[model samples]
Target chain A: MNPKDTSTGTLSYEQAGVNYDLIDPLKVAAQRAAAATGANLAAHGFTEVPASRGESAYVVDVGPFYLASIVECLGTKTLVADDMQKLTGKSYYDSIAQDTIAMAVNDLITVGATPLVVQAYWSAGGSDWFGDAQRSQALVAGWKRACDTCGVAWGGGETPALAGIVEAGRIDLAASCTGLVNPKERLSVGDKLAAGDAIVLLASSGIHANGLSLARKLVERLPQGYLTKLPDGTTYGEALLAPTVLYSPVTEALYKAGITPHYCANITGHGWRKLLRHPATLTYRIDKVPPVTPVLRFMQEHAKQDDREAYSTLNMGAGFALFVRAQDAQRTVEVAQAAGVAALVAGRVEAGPKQLLIEPLGIRFGDDDLQLR
Target chain B: MNPKDTSTGTLSYEQAGVNYDLIDPLKVAAQRAAAATGANLAAHGFTEVPASRGESAYVVDVGPFYLASIVECLGTKTLVADDMQKLTGKSYYDSIAQDTIAMAVNDLITVGATPLVVQAYWSAGGSDWFGDAQRSQALVAGWKRACDTCGVAWGGGETPALAGIVEAGRIDLAASCTGLVNPKERLSVGDKLAAGDAIVLLASSGIHANGLSLARKLVERLPQGYLTKLPDGTTYGEALLAPTVLYSPVTEALYKAGITPHYCANITGHGWRKLLRHPATLTYRIDKVPPVTPVLRFMQEHAKQDDREAYSTLNMGAGFALFVRAQDAQRTVEVAQAAGVAALVAGRVEAGPKQLLIEPLGIRFGDDDLQLR
Candidate 1:
């Protein structure tokens, strides 16, 4: 028996090598330390928006506007792309590049800031990685395409060849986005979040850059590895490599429709539990949920996880959540649809406790599940 | 007998695994692709500063002020810190943290922008690395201290535990800084670069986070590795771990003293070749150079590199350079001195073909050596 095996003998994120117990404290310490440096922004005629400290993105209050910034990385998904490329002599960097950009731009829009510029950080084990013209050019092309899709400049970036620290024949990818919230009114830090708000969840495409470490772990148990096909007839690697859905257009449409979400959460890392990411003492009640993508269903069944484990550890179906007044739910969905994205009015926010309740799956996660601050 | 060895049978940067010939074309391709996305910024009421495309930082015209941003990483330096920590049983993360911040913020200041917020990207191979409270806490303390030193907010960052791609028991460090250049006139993208400017050189503590891969390679040939004592009575590891000088103070002092440099170069990756960073057809003649630090001297002697190779591949001594009008050069030096940094009027710019001339060492580097765009 595996020493780290749980009582259920099933996979867990910690078993997959990501232990929140050891990682969250450092995050907390960083936030506490970061909190003390807010005063330093004053020298540049800007002030830290105190409410944005633990939010998805960092926001600063400039005189006529606000700027939100985030630095995010596509964790381990590139490894999957690399493995798949070896199986079928094709370059997957274009799709992975879109995934990396979506990972950052999606988080930036949570604070109602439209992304303005994105700087890339590509650390390769050696300079030889760029020798493949197809892969490298695809990455360049896909980066530009993603920036065009998000309407942000593909700003200059750093391409460092770190040999010893990064493993040979591998590349680590990340992006930093700086956004603009003009007129200052678009800044949303959850101060306006309240009860009786409708929760509209935007659909996710496949796994969508989160839970990849677990998914990649699950592949080892499969007979054919990444070639295993889901029930929908698509190979597992192809499904997981589907470029993430860009949500900027939907957020921009909601703004154009004069419907500002009281709070927005990019459902990443913590799966559906991210619905309660606003840090308010309110309960998120989900009555209806989107259909799980085939790739995610395959992961759920193969991992032998129950509803609680599946919903808490994977996106399940939703990739983003928007909390707005109950009356605007249908219009929010309409705007998302018009913007070429699928969204649904799935839940409501209620006063009482800080927890997430998925009624259809009979799953609930308490506040202790996430400790970003 | 080594097939890849140079004629002199001494180590070179390419032999150490960092090959610019293989890397520069990808950068050129990326710039070509990124240049296409510059128009995207116009939708958000901002425009890309066209001249800043290939500069140290990406600058955007935000109506009243300009925002310059850069994402830089401390390449392979952390591996040295990790190695030293094992030998000394002490945490060098505090110093490495400052080095990471300086790498990004120093690049930001090169555009005449005052850093307002810095966001970190810390990617560890596994979550267990954070279990070391001393090292992790030291990183937090040092990050906050660096922010305090630069007078910039330590904005929130992403701490992703990348298991498969990054090597186990190791971490990758990078930071992104967004700065503000107020009054528009302070924005320096080398538009005013002329033939009659004087070059001011600033002293570096040691190797300020550049050419670390080569330095780490040299340690492998040493009998005692990082524990080897230098002539200065300090271990090789200790000298390399010394915190890089935060140059924001010198830039701020220059701004206060009404000394707007025609161009500024943060001497990093290309070593002294970075002194000719600005894309101008002018010759930079250096009559005097800064005193080489002891650690650098040791690396030079052991690596068996001559003056030309050493200066081109390492900082040697000067970490930053300012090209100001001849009349303002002395005042700039005095301002830097008042800010507690040593500076010297080391060179002059002349109307000639693009190149760098080290008069004292009889070294000359033509324009073909550096190709950023």
Candidate 2:
């Protein structure tokens, strides 16, 4: 049960073959090249929000309003859903749809934008994949239902059978969301993130689509694979396939309450390290942390990762975080509850060297750990 | 050289393992589900343009302007680029970037929207695929160059390593474009499309990223594979990997010249059948057709497809089509030419049934040939 027990864990995201060292430079080079093209928006009467280049979503100034756009894939979570379907005889695509939608819409809301339209990208390896009417219909029903839940129009999408590129019998799911930042002043690109800001953490529903690659790697070692039961009496597959929390409603409720977060982090691929995602030289000090869910706990123990590696590489318990004025922390939590999402004041932002300190777990992430820009 | 010789080939797209019958229905089902979620847009002060549901791009009524968005993938074209790279000792990713960008941005402009920002999605089977710095940098340089050429900002993008979904050593390329359909009067979802409009056909640059699955299937039958040369002495892979034309500038130029097309069709996927894609019951009579490019001609000769199949499946020569009043035909051609795109008056829209007729080639496509909704 302790992360300090490293004897059993050898799992890290990099060891799962998704090394940031190889991937991050490409992103940094891309950001530099992307920065040069910002002026191109002027031709269409839209100007690029200079600081939005490396943010969760790309924001553009469209005269009276700022529009944000993001494209995100659900990663390998659907593979888990597929594997579970084989064991349980149930198509979990309804939740797969929610996870896919949340991955993109959640990132869009990080910049204080409310998503208006979402388009689906479903690329399958072969046409036979759709011949299974149950799975296909479940996907369709789920996509529409998720879009409705997020309050975004189910805009047109492309369904291509990419035979030779994508592996056979599998489908790759991704979504693109376009949102509006009305009133202009609501656009939060970390410009207002400063010292003494309160940090509100939102509870996640299991892994929530991140760290699935590492989680999938861990499954191979288990004697029973996805069918193995955790202490909670649920199969490992059921816990790992839990749907992601859609945070758009929480951001909407906060907006309605007239509380604009100085910055928000959609805790995704980079884990808690995302808390320092904004390019600000400040310390993120945490006094408390959420309890580890059963699935993540099972995965952490089986993978044999220490506290530092688990907290920085996986969401652990907090799926999302919002930085606000000190007095607004409790209000942010209440607003999330009104929208049916649980939240807590997990930490505070302080004027210090750039880093994150999870005091309860004794884990620290330095400024050099993340290099998005 | 005649397309009537179908005896030598059984290489239809369906036989190549990409069946439209199996794929299109899922799209239709998804579209129906998507339609139910259009009401969600109203919550963000945006209304869904009803007729836009089945169009190439999704349009939203944003008061002073209509916004259009589209997501499209290059579809195994990068596989061709990869094979060609292995043979030629050079990466054609610069052109690959253009093809990927064109797939989405061109579709966005079909609704008379000018692209404002384009985000890239480069997903590979593993991280090692990006280790080839030469190939990766070429892709980055090409993406930036294409965005600059289209007068759109290069908004942020996602590059994930999808281990088991995408095939190893291969990358899937796609883009999501958000564009502005300014003045509201410029938005064209075929409401104004009618008889007596001229059809201006714009020439294509080789295959332009479509029909590659069939094209790739043809490669296996060749003794030398990708290095095999055509009648023009260019290698089969070289011609197939040519960059797709960027038509955003043409749309922008037409708007500047005070000419609003009744409707426009980006000739992709369904080939000449796309001429009748507007859902209007009218006959598109093609008096003359652009000369088929060498690569497509080679593919037709090798694949032995009849004229009807060739015209109905591949772009053949025309890359884009614009439907405007007959009087504006010459001006449209001149405008496209001024923007450096070769275009000519190839046909006329006539009152009749829903179909497209290539008079010169004696090829015809019924309305049932394509069903996007």
Name the regions of candidate 2 deviating beyond 4 angstroms. A1-9, B1-7
Compared with the true structure, what per-residue lDDT tens digits does model 2 show for residues B253-351?
999999999999999987888897888789999999888999999888888888888887899999999999999999999999999999999999999
lDDT: worst 10-residue window of model 1 chain B: B1-10
User: Per model, how much of the real contact set is kept?
Assistant: 0.88, 0.81
lDDT of 1 by residue, A1-373 (tens): 2544643468877777688888888988998999999998877767889988878899998787887888999888999999999998888999999999999999999988988999999998789888888999989989999999888998889888877767888899999999888767888889888999999999999899999978888887788999998888889999999989989988888998999888899988878878767777999899999999899999988888888998888888889999899999999999999988888999899988899999988888999987666
DockQ of each: 0.84, 0.82
Q: Which stretches of model 1 miss by more than 4 angstroms?
A: A1-8, B1-8
The number of residue pairs in model 2 that clash at the backbone is 3
Indicate the DockQ of the complex predicted as candidate 1: 0.84
lDDT of 1 by residue, B119-163 (tens): 999998888888889999999999999999999898889888876
Compared with the true structure, the alpha-carbon lDDT of candidate 2 equals 0.88
- Candidate 2 docks at the CAPRI level of high
